[model samples]
Structures are given as structure tokens and as C-alpha cells.
Target: MNQNLVIALAQVNPTVGDIDGNLARARAVRAEAAAAGADLVVGGELLVAGYPPEDLVLKPAFIDRVEAAVEAFARETADGGPAFLLGAPWQMRGRLFNAALLLDGGRIAAVTRKYDLPNYGVFDEKRVFAAGPLPEPIPFRDARLGVLICEDMWTAAATAALAERGADLLLVLNGSPFEFDKPDVRLDLARARAAESGRPLAYVNLVGGQDELVFDGDSFVIDASGAVMARLESWDERMAVTRWRARDGVWVCEPAAVAARPVGEEAIFAALVTGLRDYVDKNGFPGIVLGMSGGIDSALSAAVAVDALGADRVRLVAMPSPYTSRASVEDAAETARLLGAKLESVSIEPAMQAFGHMLAGLFAGRPADETEENIQARARAVTLMALSNKFGHMLLTTGNKSEMSVGYATLYGDMCGGYSVLKDVYKTTVFALARWRNRERPAGALGPGGRVIPERVITKPPSAELKPNQTDQDTLPPYDELDAILRGLVEDERSIAEMTAGGFDETTVRRVWRMLHRAEYKRRQAPPGVKITHRAFGRDRRYPLTNRFTDLA
Candidate 1:
């Protein structure tokens, strides 16, 4: 028997529910792999129907169409150049399954269904697909290959079963979403699995943006000794080929070119860019327009938009009120100029005055307070919305997670937009991203390089500028302290007592917790944004608006 194999990993992006388009992409990639003399071509999980088809899989008609497409793809392999392993939904015995098919010789040779279904934190696979039975390795050209779909590899049982069944190599397909530090976590898991099974492993992950989730395709190959042999680039689309040969009675993969992975803040920034770009282009938006206040949040949002869509497609509007400082105006203009985007100045003084005059009679005895400040914000929102309507540009809201955690943002005002670019980002990280953009521009960015965000914007005290000498600190805790408390409550779900014992002030923690619970109503109405953390506000954490149960313990 031949002891050599060539496998091509197709790291292509697929739009959800675009069956025809997805199949075309698959055919194109399979042709490329065949030309390269690969023995087999493998794709990501759910490649035919796209990952997370969600409730779409419940429709029998959709599954029929997907099966038809898979058959058509299988027929094309009759030319005998390369075999294909493609992902699709299968219906058998009135049960739906997430399945991978082996296509060779103008027909499907075998099928493997997913054994494990993930149910927590942006995953509801169990809700849509029935759990498949334990799988056996399939016979290939010269070896027995074991297939593990995504979550199946996270546990040791599946690998052990495949190894016990005499599988020679393990191939894992994934639709894994990108999170901070996820690459390290994935590598560690692969190493452990390889060590346990005593076989080489190949992993291919889906790449692209799907609503709030961004899949960073860091596909890799590892030797049985638990060393990385090849790694594909993240945040981009490409096909990586790995060659294997049997030596000393053990199959080993040859070392190939490995792409470096982005880490920390850089990985976070890349995710943001990919998420925004796909949302705009896939949704068919003409361009994007955002309110460019001189503060760091808006500055960072504008930079991300320009980088994702280019300076020409990004429009910046600075709506200054009576309390808007000259320094703010200068900073906004300077930032726009540096990024090579046009800044449109729209003063909201007249609109604010008109609203105040209209409400003067109703506020005869009430003292002027946050109500008046909200009027200024609402007026700016109206101006921005008008531009969005007239120009057909998608409005991008710039509120960060810190403000969203507390009841700090005005509803129907700054929160009014088609999308929230910084909805999942913390205020502290916002400042850091602004500085990072100035230092280094990311790859595939369309904007001009060097100091995209002005320095003063990063150093200045953050403010809504609704009143004289107003700063965020007047109404909220310092960002560092506030963010720490927020992570404890929102991400970690820690109790008030726990946070206090961890060196946080009791009174401050209680106050922030109260604000966090009170703002659930606002967050419910906020626009969708990219999720970078493991526990983002939207799909990850769900809480009732009327709940009075406080974590005083």
C-alpha cells in the first residue's frame, strides 16, 4: 500500500444561507487543490450550508437543497483528480444531523456525523441538530482517516475511540469563533489531543464574519509528538497544503510554512476590522457615517470604520453643541484630516434651543437637569440620522461597553444607529486601540498610515460635554476601576461581596452593580456589534429587566 498522502486545507469564508454561492466557492477551491496534486481536499464544518444555520435547518426544503448541492459537488469529482470531504446537514430516519461526507469516484464513500453539540455562549447546536453516534474511521487511498467535527475534539473520548478503531490520522473541522487568547487555547487543546491519541492531527477552521461572530481561520497541523508542523494565517482566506509519509511504522507530516498568529490587542483589532467590513459589504451598505466627537470612543470608531471601508467610504460629522469646547472641535477636525476623511461640522445649538423653548412651559416648576442635557444629545442624533437617510450610509454608534454597563448613555440619542462598532469594547481598551492604530496600521487597512488618531484625544479627560466643565468622572468611577468592577460583574458574574474582598470598594461596587442592572433595558435596544470577549452583553449574558435580585452577598 502507498504510504504517502497530500491534503489541502481550504480556509474559505462562507455566507450563511447562501447555498449556491457556497457550493461555487467549494468547487473552485476543490479545483485548486486537485491541480496542486493533493490526494484529498477538506473544508470547514457546515461548509455547504454555512455554520450556525440556526433555525434554518429545521426546514426540510432547505436541507433538500443542501443535499442536492452536495450531490452535484460529488459528481464533479468523477474526473478522479482528488477526493473531497465536505460539510452539510443530513436528514436520516426523520432526524437532522450536522454531517461531513467523503466524496470520491463520483459518489459518497462514507459519512460522519457530529457527536457533540455545544449549547452555551453563542452556540445552540444541540437545539438544532441531533447528537450523532460515535464514529469509526473510514478507509481512504492508503490509510484509515478519523474525522472529528469541532466540539468533538475538545474531549478525549472521541479521539480515543478513533484510535482504538485503528485510525491512522485525525482530521478535525471547525466553525470556531474568534475570542481573545483563543489561539493559544486551541493550540493547547490540539497538543493534548495529539499526545493522547498518539497520531498526527489536522485542524481547519472557518474564516469570516457572521453577524456578531468573527471566525479567525488559524488552521494548523501537528505531529504525533505534539509539535506544530504548519499553521494558516488568521483573519484571511487561503489554502494550506500539508504532505505526509509513513516512517518507522508511524505516519508523520512534513514541516511546512507556518503563519504567525496575532495576539493580544492586535488580534482584537483585527477581529473588529473583519467584523465591520463584512457587516457593511455583505449587507450591501453604500458606506458608513458616524458622529465623530473629539473623545476617544468616537475617535477609535472612526479609525476602525475608515480602516475597514477606506477613508473615501467613511464620512465623519462633528455636531457641536453650545457646551462643545473649541479644543474638541480642533481635535475632531485634526483626527478627520489625519485619517484622510472629510469632517462635516453641524452645530446643534439651534435645534437644542428650539426643543428647550417647546418644553419650557412643561418644566415651569422643575429644575433644569439631565433632561436638558438629553435634549442636546437627541438633537445631534436627529442630525446624524438625517444624514444617514439622505446619503444611504449605515450609521455607526460609538458607545463602549463601560458606558453600556451603566446607565450612562442617552437613549434614542447617541444610541441611535444602524450598528454599534464599539458595543462590546471597554472604554479602557478603546483608548489603547486608538494609540495602537497611531503606532501601527493593520494589514489590508484602506486608510492612510501614521497617527490616524490625534494624541490629545487619547490624553484628554472623557466627557459627554452636556454641561460646563463636565467630565465622565463626575458621574462615574474612574475607567480603570469601573472596567475592573464591570469585568467582575458582567464577565465573571462575581457577587458584590466577592468583588469587595478582591480589594474593590464596597460602595462603588454596589453603585456600579445597580447601574448595570438598571441599564438592561437600554442594552436590549442597542445595535449589534462585534463580540471580542468570552462574555459579551448580547448573546452571552441574558438578564431580565425587572429582576430585583441583587448580588449583595
Candidate 2:
């Protein structure tokens, strides 16, 4: 029996389409593991090609480059340091599959393909790659390791088979995306697998944002008895090394440090910060510029931006219209001052007058109504966009999920931006996040310590201020009720009757259901944002732009 072994879990951040950079990152981590005397270094799924290569896997040239890079990195193991267990898109006999490779002794020692390809919500792996047959335990030095890809661990078939085959350890490579309370779900699943197989398990997950999805790197190890032996930090890149020993023909992971995981609003806030930070940094944007209307939505957006990219990189512009209140202006200024971000006042009154005059002739006798309010919103949009263009900064939209659920948002007005940090965050969660940020600054946050958002920002009535005395409640239900209703309609996919049965008014349910379907066209054009909920607007819940079917019954 082997006296001792060391395994290092590499929680990495890889950009999709940056094949060379991804390989370089793997090499750096492998070197770090070698310096720490690790016997093997395990990485997250598709670390070579950067998880969910999407259609990039379709290109023969892209696959060719990835293969060459993996082979090259495999050959580097000839140095006799630490062996690497890596993941990449592999081509075997005219078909592509998600695979994990064991690199040792200067060659590819073993290969295991992913048996389960997830196809539901935010995952379309079935369309891109074929599912491989059930994987067998791969042979390493003294241990036969049971390997499960991200989705493979969700089911029991793979784990049971590997355990029956006399495998000594279970290793999982994951590219799991972040959702509210998903960390707990993953932990529960891992514990179940460990208890069923009677084998200790090691899980490695990717970190950082990819497009609208963010991966929380909460890599952890569970003992055979379903106890956590080691846990890594979440929302950041880290490399955790665990020591193991073979005792009485069974492998036991020696007790190691367990880092605390964020919960509730704290986890959601970290996801927002990580998502926005990676989106701006990975896309090569110098900084971000957004409209600060002193409303809860924009105030929270500014605080997230300042925390994500620092105050210097965040520029806040107050685009006040005639209907904008003095209290709102003061709140915006105060929020900026607290966050230490630069704020510039840009009145859209001139643009409003120009648009009013430009459309006066066409309006003829039409009385001013929501059309005027839309013009005001568009005028503000133009002002913020001009600054974004001149300063080479990406525009950050601040509309929350509640406004977007119905048709309350103006398309091409408040919806225009390079990215949105709060797109998936509901109005109710927005208030919670604002209050949390004011009291506590998250770890690795670049913003100030005490309070980034003013207390008044959270307490004030939520409004868009597109017109005089405009509050969100005038067009939509109260946020708490609206979010609960939306959770049933969108997340739970319940019918109007079902929502009504769930203690909501039937009329309000019908009205919300209609607006949700009618606004599909606008949502299609909304910018990408952090997906914190199980059912975000983009890839998570896609609806047809032209549809007549309603769940009214």
C-alpha cells in the first residue's frame, strides 16, 4: 500500500476561445503544485478549451489547436514533477466528446470521456458533443480513481459502477455555474455520492465569469463517511492541496482547512461582483460608465461597479430630466461620494426639448402620455451613451428583473448598454443587496468599507423618474409581491391559475403573465448580465418573439 499521496485542486479562471491562455494558466498551476510536492494536480472540466466552448468545438481548426496544446502540455510532464489530470474537448474517431486526460511520465497515461452531457437550462452540451459510454476507473500509481465529469456526478449510475469496479477514490471535474443557494445543492450531492460509494471524493470547479454565467470555485473534498475534510474559498481563484494516506486498504483524506462559504445575500452579492468584474476585465474594457438616477437599481449598480473594478474605473453620470426630483439628485451624489466614484451631472433637458420639437409636427393633436415618458428615457440614454463612446468605457444598464419581467422598461432606452450587473436581480433582491453592501463589504471588494450605498437609497420609493411622480408601483405591483409572483410564473413555470391558487390575485397574475409574454421582444435586445437566479432571462428562459398562446386559463 502507498504510504502517502498529495492531490492539488486547481480552481482556475479560463476565458472561452483563449486556448493558448488557458494552456498557459494550466502550466502555471501545475508548476505551483510541483513546488508544493504534490503528486497530482486536478483541474476543472474543459480547462484546456475553457468550458462550454460552445460552437467553437465545431471548427476543425479550433479542435486541432486544442489537441496540439494538450499534447504539448502532456509532454512537459517528462520533468518528473507532478502529474496533471486535465480536461478538454477531445476528438476520438470522427466524434467529439468532453474528456479528461491523465498526463504522467511525459505522455497521456489514460483518458475518460464524460458520460452525461447536460442539456437543460443554460446547458446545451447534447447538441455539441456526444455522450461517451460509462467511464471505468482510470489507473494511476497506487489508486484506481473513479472520475465523473460535471453532469455525471448528478446521477448515481456512474458512481455506482466505478465503486463496484473497486476504485479507491472519486474525482469530479466541474464547470458548474453559480445560482442562488447552488453551493449547498452541490455539497449535498457530493455527500450523497461519498456515502453511497464508500469512497472519498475530490471536487474541482472553475471560477470567474463567462459571458452571462459566473462559476463559483467552491472546490471541496468529502471523506468516505460523508464528512468534509477540505474546502476551498469561493468567488476567487485558488489552489488547495490535500494530503491522503492509504490505511487498511482504504484511502482517507487527512483533515485540512475548511474555508467558510458565503450564504444568502452575501453569496448573491459576490456573484454579482465576480460576474461584473470578469465581464469588464476579460472583454478588455478600460472601465464602465452608467447612469446614476438615485433610484435603488442604479445605486446598487454603481456600488457593484465600484466594488468590482474600483472607484476610479467606475464613472457615474446623473442624467436628470425635468421630472427628476431634487431628492433623487442628492441621493445619487451622496451614493457616488460614499463609493468614491466620479460623478458628473448631465441634464437631458436639452435633448428632451429637441426631441419634443422634432416630434411636435408628427404628434399633431396627440396628447402627451407614455410616449413623452419614453422620449425622456431615450434622451437620457443618448446622453449616457455619448459619454461611454467618448471615454471608451462600456455602458452598464441598471434595469432590474422586476422592470424587465413586465414591459415597463423602454427598449433602446434604459436597456441599451454593453452589460448589466443587475439584469437578473429582482427589485426585491436589489433592496436586500443594497442594504447588505451598506453594512458589509465583501471580501476582495475594491470599494470603500463602511457604506457604499446611502440608507435613503434603499428606503426611498423605487422610481424611474421618466415623468413627474413616476414610481414603479404606478405600473407594476409592489416588489415583494411581484418577485413572489414572478418566481412562480418564470422559475416554477406555473400557469396563471396556478399562480392565483398560490395566494396571488387572479387579475394581477393574468396581467403579469401577459406583460411577461408581450415583452419577449424587448428582452431579446436587453444586454447580458449576471445570472443569479435559476431562471434568468437569457439562455435560461428563452421565449419566442412572436407567440399568441397565453396561460390565462
Of the candidates shown, which would achieve the greatest TM-score relative to the real structure? 2
The CA root-mean-square deviation of candidate 2, after full C-alpha superposition on the true structure, stands at 1.0
Per-candidate alpha-carbon RMSD to the true structure = 1.3, 1.0
Candidate 1, backbone clash total: 0
Worst 10 residues of 1 by lDDT: 244-253
What local lDDT score does residue 404 receive in model 2, on the 0 to 100 scale? 90
Model 2: clashing residue pairs?
none
Q: What tens digits encode model 1's per-residue C-alpha lDDT throughout 203-237?
A: 99999888888999999999988899999999998
* Model 2 lDDT-worst window of ten: 544-553
**Model 2 residue 529 CA deviation in Å:** 0.6
lDDT of model 2, residue 436: 89
What's the lDDT of the predicted structure labeled candidate 1? 0.90
Off by over 4 Å in 1: none
User: For residues 440-496, what per-residue lDDT tens digits would candidate 2 score against the true structure?
Assistant: 989999999998888888898888887778788988888899889998989999988
The total number of steric clashes, by the backbone 3 Å criterion, in model 2 comes to 0
